[model samples]
Target: MTAPEPAEPPAAEPGVTAAEPAAAGPDSAARPGAEPAEPTDADAASHSAALPGADLDGADLDGADLDGADLDGAEPAGALPTERAAAGVPGKRGRRRVAPAPEPAPVLDDAELRGALEAILLVVDEPVSELTLAQVLEQPAERIGPALDRIAAGYTAAGHGFELRRAAGGWRLYTRPEYATYVERFVLDGQSVRLTQAALETLAVIAYKQPVTRSRISAIRGVNCDGVIRTLVSRGLVEECGTEADSGAFLYRTTTLFLEKLGLNSVADLPPLAPFLPDDVEELADATR
Candidate 1:
């Protein structure tokens, strides 16, 4: 039996330093006097590896390199504006600056504005919201708000008998405190030290919404009614019922005298206030301070 010997290596071409593989394709095969082939992605990556400490972090490892040729000249997806700038990529601008919100235009001339606000205030029993007023006047809320303030300030500056003040989440006209005494005296003339309008209003709230706290009454009436509550208690029309379960605030309710004074047999006999109240009365009560 004879052993076979390994074949000898193939002879190199005259100009080539090494012999090429037998099955090499045209692009892959070595040639005589051929210019250096353009580098492919793998070749470029190998070339980049030889340059140690050179930053290629931002470079595309695939066919799409920093030049972004493979991207059809599009900016790299998800690149921020500043990043695109650093990469020397051109960027289209964003949408034009949104036009500055138009200023609240004048809803009415000064005279008409004052007249309109005053007319509304004079007739309103309860405080009215600026939003409500704005809707009525067909004006923006911003316009209505400032006009109300200016009207309030002007009235104060002129020392008017009545004043425009904000309470119960709204604006209202009230007799100036300095004149409240005179107003009470006139409104109470010849009466048996009777309830003033405020006392009456407070009593009515307790009658309608008994088992409520003093704060609740004030919230509904849009004024601090602590004194009025005390007056009603002293007059035997209201009494402390119990504490509110959650807040532990002292709750008040109408006394038997309340029914007698109103000529009602029971609370259910009291007149319904639906026609005079807003639909969102519960929300109103909650929102008001």
Candidate 2:
């Protein structure tokens, strides 16, 4: 087999002419039309190859190579590029610019809200009130009320051992009646304080209708409640005040300790209640009369 011959260079395009060879490179010896070097230190002492377009402003060569060609006059290709000024063609004035930071989205995730509520509930040694919760969450008190009710309902529906209840004017976590023994083990030092039926009824009435007069309580309950009121007063759950303006009877009200036991911070934290009046027509007629 014959060895292949090296191919000849192609002719330049018709309208274009070839460039004169740069004087700075060793390739000057091989080029057909080489330029003479200027009388300078580079021309007199050194033989170097000149690169076309290497003198462009802001060009960098540290990241590139000139392959032993002349680089002294070059702005290297690796040089940092200049930021272009906004044009009103130089010094005429340009648009004022601002860099904006990325904004986060505003959305309340259900799981996140539930977690926050649960965490708040756990941290409170007593019942957490909706008003206080509203303040903490930076939401309206009305909004907090519905959220508390939903949470309360969820706990009940899930058959959770702990129940959510309102007492002193706040919300509180409590053990169910069936689990009172275990709860009592943690709460009571040794013995439980037993409450009487009369005491319970009186406390319930006072809790439901507070700042009420003794006569009004007597009227509703259909019994003299002086002894029960005394018991409640002694227990620190109820307190007495000046006579009602309408009937001139002593006014009775529940106390802060009542709130503490109920796990409330205020009366507003109590669950919404049904009408306290009897539903029967006879009872309503008798009461009216």
What is candidate 2's lDDT per residue for 131-172, written digit by digit as tens?
A: 788678765567666666788899999999997766666776
Where model 2 places Cα greater than 4 Å from the true spot, the runs are 1-108, 140-150, 153-158, 165-170, 197-228, 246-249, 255-289
- Per-candidate TM-score against the hidden true structure: 0.34, 0.41
lDDT of each: 0.76, 0.70
TM-score for model 2? 0.41
Off by over 4 Å in 1: 1-106, 192-289
| Clash pairs for candidate 1 | none
Top candidate by lDDT: 1
Predicted candidate 1 versus true structure: per-residue lDDT over 139-232, tens digit per residue? 7778788888899899999988987877645677778778867988899785767689998888888878788998888877778999888888
**What's the lDDT of the predicted structure labeled candidate 2?**
0.70
User: Which ten-residue region of model 2 has the weakest summed lDDT?
Assistant: 87-96
